[model samples]
Target chain A: MRRMSWFNATSLTLGFVFLYLPMLILVIFSFNASKLVTIWAGFSTKWYGELMRNEAFLDAAWVTAKVAVASSTLATVLGTMAALVLVRAGRFPGRTLFSGMIYAPLVMPEVITGLSLLLLFIGIGLDRGVLTIVLAHTTFSMCYVSVVVSSRLVTFDDSLEEAALDLGCSRLEAFLLVTLPIIAPAVISGWLLAFTLSLDDLVIASFTAGPSATTLPIKVFSAVRLGVSPEINALSTIMITIVAVGVITASLVSKRAAVKRRNEEQAAGRA
Target chain B: MRKFALIALPYTWLVLLFFVPFLIVLKISLSDLALARPPYAPQLDLSAGWQGIKDFFGGLDFENFIWLTTDDLYWKAYLSSLKIAVISTLLTLMVGYPMAYGMAKAPEEWRPAMMMLVILPFSTSFLIRVYSWMGILSTEGYLNQFLLGLGLISEPLMILNTPVAVYIGIVYTYLPFMILPIYAALDKLDGSLLEAAEDLGCSRFTAFWLVTFPLSRSGMIAGCFLVFIPALGEFVIPSLLGGSETLMIGKVLYEEFFNNRDWPVASAVAVVLLLILIIPIVLFQRNQQKEREAGQ
Candidate 1:
């Protein structure tokens, strides 16, 4: 057991407080009856009720949800394929460049990605709307998904697929029956990550989204840019809650999967 | 055929969406802005065949690049962004390193949860996270209220819409980037190394400064790169948290495109930003390669 000194304890506590305090304040202030950040008015859920009544916020949210679902699904597919290419297709031609492209967007500025893609849409004469937004989201978020899935792929045993092949399983069949089942957790988590990215993205979505098709972040941005409002706080509180739950669930799912995989391996070895 | 299909699918997707778009940015950056619907000159009219390609190349110039250089705003924004990204990265390191060290020193069973605690912010909307601070940093915000209530200051300090707010936002948002890398390094350090140093007649602090810190250099470097590179071109944090004086290339590029509708100039700005980024990105890649080699 590593010793937790006074310094370490204080650092951890203070660090976490710094991290969580603002969000906690936002969430708590969301229920305030008055539209003040500091003043504690009586607790009421009126802001949330107002949020429900707001048609524009609701419509933007609906559009965001639709974009998230479509883009994340598409990203998962392309990302998994890219991961397979990076991991399994060893020493292929242009492998370095391929991997470079895969990783580049991870650190690329949101502005550059957004600007370039918008230019592409205009250059190719593609209309800026939900479809353009989906394409842009898929392009960037796929890099993230590939990173997640490829990390899992690295630790995966190559012999397991070989065992399936030795039993006369076709390559495709072996992949579907053996490889896919084991890596499903990573892929699922990848999808979740992509989904969250799509939902949270502001800059990329803003550039790609048409004036008529504003996403929640763009709407929230315009609203918050003026000043803090209880309605914006309520929206943020809800988003923070959703994302926290989603991230936790994804992490837990992956952990559980690892344990389950170990148990199945142990059982098979004993047999 | 199957192998070909697997490679081609994603390769084509990236080439089209990623690489091709980048080339278009490069091309447009050279061309002059036009009042046309698509808003750039010398787009190839293929019906004109060989003559069109010649015209396209002929119309391209270094003027946009020159314009960016001549404008004090563009270069100043670039420099200010560099200054901001560098300072914030250092701040994040100072704030993050201790937390990471604490996590590494924690009891084994508690480490995972602590790590998750660090990552939980990522799941939240970034705009919301930055916006959360506005309420706290504003004159009537909680921080000021608390300070005034405690009799720390008679007047509320103007923190919102200032460079200080932008710094706080960057450090808050990018803390995880710095922490995770440093934590990974610290976690992998063999406790025996510190003990060995201590047995050689060194204090715990000296032992850490000499042995553990040197060992964790790679992680520290990686963490810095991760923080600095993204922070350099960050749009959302600066735009939301920054005052008009908080000049960043990302926000400038954004305004150039959306507000001014100067697509050529916008593309030129992006091209330059990418050029500036190539240095750190290349170093990051080399660092990653070295780490991988060391692992092997």
Candidate 2:
């Protein structure tokens, strides 16, 4: 038993090291004053300063932010509706095909999807640019958002909407007044997920994006191919910090919400 | 009325934008390559006319499909991609399972922290992570530096710009993918069953093999497919680390479409890849449906 515990602890520690040590090193070297990625001379914020000064990097970052916001917002709206239909609508002809179509992009190789879309755009006389990137991003992003929202919808009790309807409210009113409020959290979470996916995507973006429409991931990818740089590390560190903050905040908010609900139930019981 | 429109609108958008493009690719794949044009026009049977009443067999050729099978280059790349994907997936499973098991056994408070550690790296740019491997595996990079510092080697090993580098890059990027699903599965595992096994005469290894491993098979399968399929289609990692000598299908397809400007050939290559991937895709979807049904 003791031997088993030791083995488990060792293996787990090794696993953690495997997963993290490289990231830790990258973060550390981001602050290194040396230009060479391997040799760390001394700690400095000069690479970050260089990143701020570089107009190309800033432009790419701005493009990425815009794409994430635009694509994710559109995805959230479309996905919510798709989820509603999938979960609430009665049997309809071709429902299986619709479901398959919605989820197909999730598993289909991004390269194939990108290639197919690129071909379609050319066939339609559409140029490869930001518009193409946004359209492509929206395609897969909506699927993810729908999956998240529909999963949340599955747990929702139909009785709440039905009760509102029973009180002489129209179906639309009931949905707006009851169902919409209940699933609002799901919509927001789905949007966040969509945003992150859009921001992180590279392959599809590479295929769809024109020279003028370089997103941050594509920029970083090209830079990495040329050679590793401290500036890229600086950029990575900043991005990691942002994602970590978002995740931590989301967890805390959810935990707080759970506690508030529990306390309200207790108060109601006492009353 | 508004609700009906709301639901109908998105489905229409998906059909027009998503499904149409795929249909176009399928159509083009079946058509003969248009010679002497930048955008190769797909061969069409105008003899069928507007009504399109004709034999389905007469419309398209399986020449592209035949080419994919007979062509030595295509077969070689496909085989190499399969071999790499399988080996890397197996390595990921071996490494990930123990870590997931340990995470599952950790104190409740620690589980979230561990999960965060795993997912945090994922949230960062994948490009950077793959790039980071370059710095580590390069001839004069950290791994060589550390080894040289330790007097482990007289000269820096030539690890970069090889198939081994491609393998390392792939395995590094995909390890988290294998870890997360397995961890989720093990996290939801019932402790009582393991306790029962222990109470009975089962040893720890026997109990894990008989009880935990079988129970976590779904997660294992999910993780493997997720890693394997994507790894097979991977372009960036191999492009960056595999150097010029290594030839994977994704890179080949990219060169065909962009460099050589051969859309028909690229489409043919893609059709072949889709065929190879169809089995895993079906299996994954079926497993997901089963899970959903079981959940409900």
- Relative to the true structure, how large is the alpha-carbon lDDT of every model? 0.92, 0.84
Candidate 2 deviates by what RMSD? 2.7
After superposing candidate 1 on the true structure, give the runs of residues whose Cα lies further than 4 Å from its correct spot.
A1-3, A91-93
Interface RMSD (Cα, Å) for model 1:
1.1
Q: What is the clash count for each candidate, in the order shown?
A: 0, 0
Which ten residues in a row are the worst by lDDT in model 2 chain B?
Answer: B36-45
Most accurate candidate by DockQ = 1
Tens digit of lDDT per residue, candidate 1, span B171-222? 9998999999999999999999999999999999999999999998999999
Residue A134 error, candidate 2, Å: 0.9
Q: What TM-score against the true chain A does chain A of each candidate get?
A: 0.94, 0.95
Q: What's each prediction's TM-score?
A: 0.97, 0.93
Candidate 1 CAPRI category: high
